[model samples]
Target chain A: MAPKLPPHHSLQHSSTTATAGGQVHDDHDHHPQPRGIMRWLLTTNHKEIGSLYLIFSLIMFFIGGIFALVVRAELFQPGLNLINPEFFNQMTTMHGLIMVFAAVMPAFTGLANWMIPLQIGAPDMALPRLNNFSFWLLPVAFTLLLSTLLMPGGGPNFGWTFYAPLSTTYAPPSTTFFILSLHIAGVSSILGAINIVATILNMRAPGMRMMDMPLFVWTWLITAFLLIAVMPVLAGVITMMLMDINFGTSFFDAAGGGDPVLFQHLFWFFGHPEVYIMILPAFGIVSAIIPTFARKRLFGYASMVYATASIAVLSFLVWAHHMFVVGLPLAATLFFMYTTMLIAVPTGVKVFNWITTLFRGSITFEVPMLFALAFVVLFTIGGFSGLMLAIAPADFQYHDTYFVVAHFHYVLVPGAVFSIMAAVYYWLPKWTGHYPSEILGKWHFWLSVIGVNLTFFPMHFSGLAGMPRRIPDYALQFADFNLVSSLGAFLFGFSQLIFVWVIIKCVRGGVKAPAKAWDGAEDLEWSVPSPAPLHTFETPPDFKPVQH
Target chain B: MMNPVQRTVFRSVLVLIAMFAFAFALVPLYDVFCRITGVNGKVDERAQTLVSEEVDESRYVTVQFITRSGSGLPWILDVEQRQVRVHPGQPTEINFAFTNQSGSALSGRAVPSVSPSQASRYLRKVNCFCFDEQRLEAGERVEMPLVFQLTRDLPKDVNTVTMVYTLYPVAEEKAQLQAQVAPGSGGDA
Candidate 1:
């Protein structure tokens, strides 16, 4: 059992044997890929599978956006307008589900799939077939999730958190399907996470050390670990819901000797870490973009990595923060409050580091850079609101209010979603061999920033004024803010079309890109040709340690 | 087929299955938490040893008995007297009357819940009919006895303690008896 050669060495060994003058090297016998739909179905190529994940997530984003619009439209002017209250509930529920699970999470995973291999100078993921399987499972899961709308009693209206009793005894018949679909999605997430961990650990270029890897990869490494640790817990809770609904079990029935709050304990045990899961990758994306645009090596790269790991660890201890209003003991509430606030230290570290990276550097506001900047300012605002929500007493007022809505949207839209847009703008030239139109890109960026702020900022005023969330109609006092929010939502939603146009134009060919597309870009990825070769790094690039 | 990566993937899949089972495990885990905290006011199933020497004679607590028939069971249940005044640590007994109003014989169970759950742990039971199921023939009427004592350690602020007994038909068990009872044969008078 001689040790097998490294993949690159083996490729070189096999190809050198097949040709006399090295003019005709054929390694396709080992790495043969078929054409057309079967390529996506049967191919183990990371880039192709990455494309699949990105495309799928983009479609889900629109679907979720539409659901949010429906919610916004109904809340536009107080009285129920376009949709019935029941459908509005469904819209909010589905919007949350699709956005969190189907859109933002998958989008981050897609970026990981596309960039991790290139950045690490590896040929492909550690287990490419498993990667493909994970990618394929998402569509199946979401399709099943969407089909539940046609269920006899309608889709899940128990809110995205799906607390028991409401989700079990009183839920529509489609609740079972919702649980099963979530289970499928959970399985997909766990599989994808495992693949990511394996790839990062096992497939880095020969000379690269753990500290030497990009911040994006570091954040993902922690995020992947969080996924592995928590997604299973999510599966566990949802399965309990399934049993309570189908079996004669009393897991959540007080009448049958079960406690409803227990369901919340189990769900938040998974749910809290899940919120970090959504945001940590955004941290990574912003970390990557800020340094590049600022023309500096990232300020305190080691601290960034430590902060990400700390946030992940702290995430587990603070899940009950979401349950403060549900009657936790004073000691328990204070403990959760302290732990939740402690998260601010590392988060503040990350924000401080980004600003320091930007200070006194030759900064330029390209589309990606602009989005990254907005992410910094707006995500911090979300963080402050989160800190307020962490104070158990203050949260009594903030919980389940439109203020809570405003807080998370600030983090998610400007925070996570903005970083995603930035990642696209930063990476598009690399993926497509052409640059997106600068004029159109800036238009998309400005509209998105304004639209996002307009949509979510007013909700804070409405929330502070005591308007509750999830209601289709609000009191007359809330009418003005709701109007502003709806108008902003429409503006934000419509402005995204310009982004689509930019991407399509780029992919169809515009300005040809050089090997290093961005002036200040640093990494193994930029060392490769634009529109990276289909099968890159047959021989892994020699590692050159980056200088600070 | 069993490459190292495949083996790792397989192990992750096993962890998933184990976690799925663990979710179900939380049901019993939650019950244990409740029991330890006495949070839900679920009385212990068996008799608790009484602290004989700590009886409080000066304080009189009002003990109220409340009974109601659960949804499907046609058992008429009520406490003969709604309330009793007793000293802490002194044993007390109350009679609850139950009648099977259904046309056929049926089995039933009564579950007890204590209000002001903070003091639930201090309400010790000496002997009670709630410990077992009671089966009765059609039109059967019987008086059941409940025996309990409040510990002297019960919070001073809790002056009144209400114990509610909700009687539920052991309907599924009754259905099981049907196969043994042979539906058309001598089940009814």
Candidate 2:
């Protein structure tokens, strides 16, 4: 028979009571954790795997950042000084591939792994073993990718887009290795996404209805679905690339009756949704952070969810916007241009909702809140530039220019990367059982803000002045901006060390945190103990839907 | 029996596999889509009825021909006539001359693009060299014929259509595949 529960604990664990054999037991026969390195190697625990992913992404961040600095250092002046154009291309390409695939994406996944189960009052991810596999595959994929640098012709120099012929016939001998590595990474993403979707849909606490789940959980659910839908498409495109390169197939070879433009079609079909895959999770993170720091319930929660869904759906239609200057027909260009512009409506709804969430609320400028606000402002700037690029005729001028570079960096750095930083600061106390040093976090945030702007802002002017991207050197006319941008890059690159230091310091020891780390934060995650126990919600917590 | 969690995971895996198949399906799907819409300048291959069904003599469209060779293809390509004016539905003939600049026998394929791409939807090719591969001996020069007609219903604003034929070097294996498919074939009709 189930033991009678006290009213307070009863409300939270109602679902536990609903289960027929829900009585708590010591369960002394639990599997013992292994010793040392093997502990992390073989653990199926979500938190442990989450830590591994977070650590891996951090390492990838610095590596990809170093590559960026190499590009910046080379472009510091008008003439080639630091490296040859060949190495420069490799740096830019690797920098993009690593930062997108390894850094920003895995960082989001790490947060999801850590927070989803806690927020939903579940014991762990639905498929914990799959979670471990996903985290492990990342390092393998990235290792193969970085190893290409040592190959005879260096790594993939043909831009991260890897437009065909350049990636096919004219590709380096190491291109095969690149394709293989991408396959591994794609498998990891697809498996990870499956785990997330299953966990979210099937593993929620009893009585925790769909709408009752936190925005972070909701956003990740959508993001996971998007991942499942599109990562396969990425796999498909890369597979075709492999067949075209190794086999005598003409999938992209025009002489073989294959159209090079077809590759772009397939790529952007996956690529456009890919942009949202990176950002939707950021939306979830910011929504959670803003509400907590504002000391109020999130404004327009339903609209926020709708907006994210609309953005995901609209993402598919606007892919051809990326090909505007690729010589699409007038009707296609117009259709894609209009569809791309329509995305701004839903995106605007999200932005307006964030500001309204803050309006007239008792707001605190915590580290997470600061980053979230910066994201709102800077991501909007990127959105405006995106709108400008959406005009098919105007795109002819901005395509392949630093303007495009600046646009994406604004969205990524402040938009996605900043949100990840905000999430880390927001949840570090819960994870570590100690509050991080606020002063150091602020310094990190300010420096990052300055560094990001300094580095990317000037690219706009240079690009508008007809400076193309992926070049090691440029005309003397663009020298001043390049110098300033490089200086900013170095400053931003080094400033991240403070973030690492802050996390380490916090983990070591600091001000003790209560179960509710933040006074205004409301979620199932906050209901758990600080330094969440090794096994959480083993008997699923009772769900009492929070009242707004 | 699988638990609810197991069922959901199994279903998700199925969806993922289906999507992977869908991605490959997109290749043929895109081809069919382009053929139907005539977007992306994909020329429709279905032979049109030769009855000269609807001829609009009142409208004359100026079609400009542009010919070029892809880099390192070792071929010089030119159109017999740079431009021609033809009444709607009236079959027009143009010739593209190709000279193999390379010393060895080479195989080449021509891809046709109709621009202002909007006009491609109404630009019907009765017969063109783009449908087949052309193989030439060293220093061989061949003139290929393209017979086409402009549909009467082509949007009134599109008074001019530029057709560009880009000659690309064919892979040896692809050339062999082409030979296998159609043996002893020269330039088509």
Candidate 3:
């Protein structure tokens, strides 16, 4: 599939100058490349920018992990042994904020940056400069957010949701900074989403139709739309917060003719879609991995795509499920409950497609496949709990409890985070020209699986047993679950160090991979050389659509 | 001439801005939705001049009044009558006594909500103290009247309506009064 390259080793420079018709002319390296730190700071190359995003998210993952560990340590034996209630609140808040905005979202974006162009046979992201700009904004945004911890009032003590009145009238002086940081992050996400949309819509190879594109690209295209639709709602909600906090507006303050419940409405409107934004890409990644390892065409490719689009649509309708305990009217409660339950149908379809794909095919449990299988089982568990919570009456029992914690953590940790680890293992051969160490990868995978389940599964029982979430202390009856959860958290947290070591080892040296890293991998990405030349498909590869 | 890539980005940015506006739009939209559906237990702040004369005498609804002082408001509030039984269209009057317990002058505004929130629309206030802020001198006490009538068309299943009035401190009024008292000192508090 390799089109003969030009004799000179030319960098695949996407034309900075946009000519008419949106045709990106490939330009060879003309100017001398800057060296060292400047190369990363000034580069607009998609691969470098992708690496930057991944690295940044990795760093944030550890930071957020440490915060989680802090909370877990405090909950180890129950009686607020390590931290005060205020600082505990900060830890939980910061942990959530960092994981959602800084870690998971960026990791997906990073993967999109690295894989989308390769899969679609594009020279680079359509908006390369914008890609550079978006990646850089995260550091500034998170730095401003982290710096709030040092401010006089000592960071956001309100939960990550930053619900009103607590975040406004009673919030510390540092909340304004948290708002600003979130604004910056929202802008970054908007720009990044726009870039992905532009790239996916405009940069596919000459013969590659929308349906012909890989699942990752398709999922990201939808995810980008979700981001564009909802990130601004987040911006708007936070801006309203800014007004309420500083401008004497009562957007959320009851004294000023504003209802605090309005805050929940606006928040969940943005937030529910944000949840999908994190997971849809995981679906895309797993869809690719399952078919590859199972050695069979995905059983229901069309159904999978339709199910994904339907899930995105249903996400908008179900935001109120999160607010069931806040006294929503019965009709509204029914509307949200029915809509929320409706979401399970599409989600179930995707899960069924995955299982059917594996039903009779030759399957090997490569590290990526192992994680993908775990994702399928555990994410379904999460989905079932979500369905339980969707029943408004049942939600009243589960709301603000460890059950809610267990549900989301099940989906996010095993579901989304595991997919990322899977993707890293799946693509490391392509990115680094070497296979990741199988023995170490298995250890990392097993420990993570055990640690994550141990950490979250007990929360289900404890939550059902009536242990509320976000508290620094627990009753003596809840002590055993807390201890086990805390130990599991530490184990899961440390296992990640092994993941980092695997990545570093793979990048430096291992069994060298060929152009097609995995035998069953059939995407346009496999057409490129391993350690994929800094410039791939500079001259567009003639894409041959494989009949599934 | 804008390229397709540039156009997609431009349109996406528009969508982003539109969604931001939509978020703010939700505030008024939510209010309108609540007003139409009576979802959030919000009682209409405007006084209703028209009171239904056709009384539903056969059906009686219990009207309960509950008063709460919000945090930071140094005031005690009491109702002269805790509960009243009235025909749906009959006007019912209740007296609320407010006492400023703080040493300094203080001002507060009352916010009202009705339980069985769907019934909020049917319970109309002919006149209420919640329509304006009340100010009191140190240790001063005042009684305010609330006259309301549940419209004859109140939901059949609803036999009782609870009106909860929570008084919140009005900071702006206190600041203005302080500025009037001391011209030299900043009234920024």
Top-lDDT candidate index: 3
lDDT of 2 by residue, A162-219 (tens): 9898999899999999998888988898888888888888888888988888988988
Comparing 1 and 3 by lDDT, which wins?
3
By lDDT rank, best first, the candidates go 3, 2, 1
Candidate 2 wrongly placed segments (more than 4 Å): A1-31, B46-62, B69-78, B85-90, B97-108, B135-144, B168-189
Clashes of 3: 0
Per-residue lDDT tens digits of candidate 1, residues B1-189? 665555655666676667667767777886787677876666798877766856688999999888877545667777878999989999888888888776667788888888766667889887777887889887799898888889888889889999988886564664454454454433221
Evaluating just chain A, the predictions reach TM-scores of 0.96, 0.95, 0.95
User: What are the lDDT figures for the candidates, one per model?
Assistant: 0.84, 0.85, 0.88
TM-score each candidate. 0.89, 0.91, 0.93
Ranking by DockQ: 3, 2, 1
Q: C-alpha displacement of A470 in model 1, angstroms?
A: 2.2
Query: DockQ (Cα-based) per candidate?
Result: 0.32, 0.45, 0.57
Give the per-residue lDDT digits (tens) of candidate 1, residues A321-415: 98997766567789999999999999999999999999999999999999999999999999999999999998998889999999999999998
Candidate 1: regions farther than 4 A off: A1-32, B1-18, B40-42, B53-108, B112-117, B128-130, B134-147, B155-189
Relative to the unseen true structure, what is the C-alpha lDDT of residue A352 in candidate 1, on a scale of 0 to 100?
98
Clashing pairs in 1: none
DockQ of 1: 0.32
